[model samples]
Every structure is written in C-alpha cells, then in structure tokens.
Target: MSEKKKGPYKQTGNIAVDMVAACINHYEKQGRKVAYIRLDFIHWTMFKGYVLEQIPAYDLSNGEIEFDDVIVTQGSSLQVKPLYHELVADGKPKVYLMN
Candidate 1:
C-alpha cells in the first residue's frame, strides 16, 4: 500500500485474475474470457483514513467517469464498531494490490 490520496474511483479494464482463472479452466472447455466491464475504484477515497466506499456515486452521465484524481468529501468518519466486528467475526474486507 503506497498511500491513500483524494480522488473518485474509476473502472480499470485489468482482469489478470480472471485471465488466470480462464487459463486454469480452459482445458475444461471454458472459453477464453467473457466480455465484461468490471467496475471498482481506481482508488477508493481514504477519509479520516480507511477505505469506506468503493466509489461515491456522482452526478455524471454514461455511468462512468475518467478518474485520475479526486477531492475529499465530507463525513470522513467510519462506523468502526460493525467493521471491527466483521473482521473479528469472519475476517472479511480483504485488501488487494493491482498494477
């Protein structure tokens, strides 16, 4: 994790994980890969500093936006109790690193 910065999240068309899955399942007659526009944050905003939401829905058209940077929104506080409970109970909210 480098560092969190201010910005809106955008979709990146990188699915190396899906590709690896395809390769692993290719011999089982699965196709190369299906066309899909997977959506996630290019960078989820770090508020007082934890990734809260994937992408804050904005008033933009086309249901997609080209995001290279972002601005900090209000209400950066997170509900810590539930999140800690989830982590302790089931070990959720996994973290990943992508290029």
Candidate 2:
C-alpha cells in the first residue's frame, strides 16, 4: 500500500493561524462572506493573544482575522447569546471546522 501525500496545509508551528488563513483564502476565492469560525477555548485564547501581540489596537468586533485582517465574523458572536450559555453549561469545546 502507498502512503497518502500531505498537501501544503500540513501542520506547522503556527498551525492555528495557518488553518485560519486557509479558510479565509478559500472563502475569498468563492466571493462569499465568511460568517464565523468555531474554536476551542485554548485555541481561541491563543488566537486572541496572538492578535493582541501583533496589533494591540485591533477591534474584536470588526469581523477580521487578526493575523491577516481577513474579514470574517468570529463564532464568538454566535455564541454570545443563548448558544454560548448552553455550550458552556454543557462543558463542550467550541471548536469547529472553518467554512
């Protein structure tokens, strides 16, 4: 049996950011607005921290990814209402596939 080949989306030191970039690129190519992306607490915290480190003045509500300013509504917006309350109550990670 032959082993499967890995594309450029392979893991890296900053895999989180790389994945986010890829999602953004995909959406942009389709000319569709990215609604949001779900991420676990750890990854979410890391992403936020990374953004702050790079651009201290970045506004979270601007619907733009911190790394490259890719416009997308963060999943947090959706979770902020009853959804977040329910998810937190259940202790489930918020991670999700970016579309």
| Candidate 1 per-residue lDDT over residues 1-99, each given as its tens digit | 113223432323334223222322342243232222222232222221222233444433443222221222222145332111000123357779999
TM-score of 2: 0.44
Q: How many residue pairs clash in each candidate?
A: 1, 0
Using TM-score as the measure, which candidate wins? 2
lDDT score, candidate 2, position 8: 40
Q: TM-scores for all candidates? A: 0.16, 0.44
**Tens-digit lDDT string for candidate 2 (2-82):** 122244444435545555656655655665534455554555666666666766877877544533333333355335431
- CA lDDT, every model vs. true structure: 0.27, 0.48
Tally clashing residue pairs in candidate 1: 1
In model 1, the Cα lDDT at residue 2 comes to 18
Model 2 error, position 59 (Å): 4.7
Name the regions of candidate 2 deviating beyond 4 angstroms: 1-13, 59-99
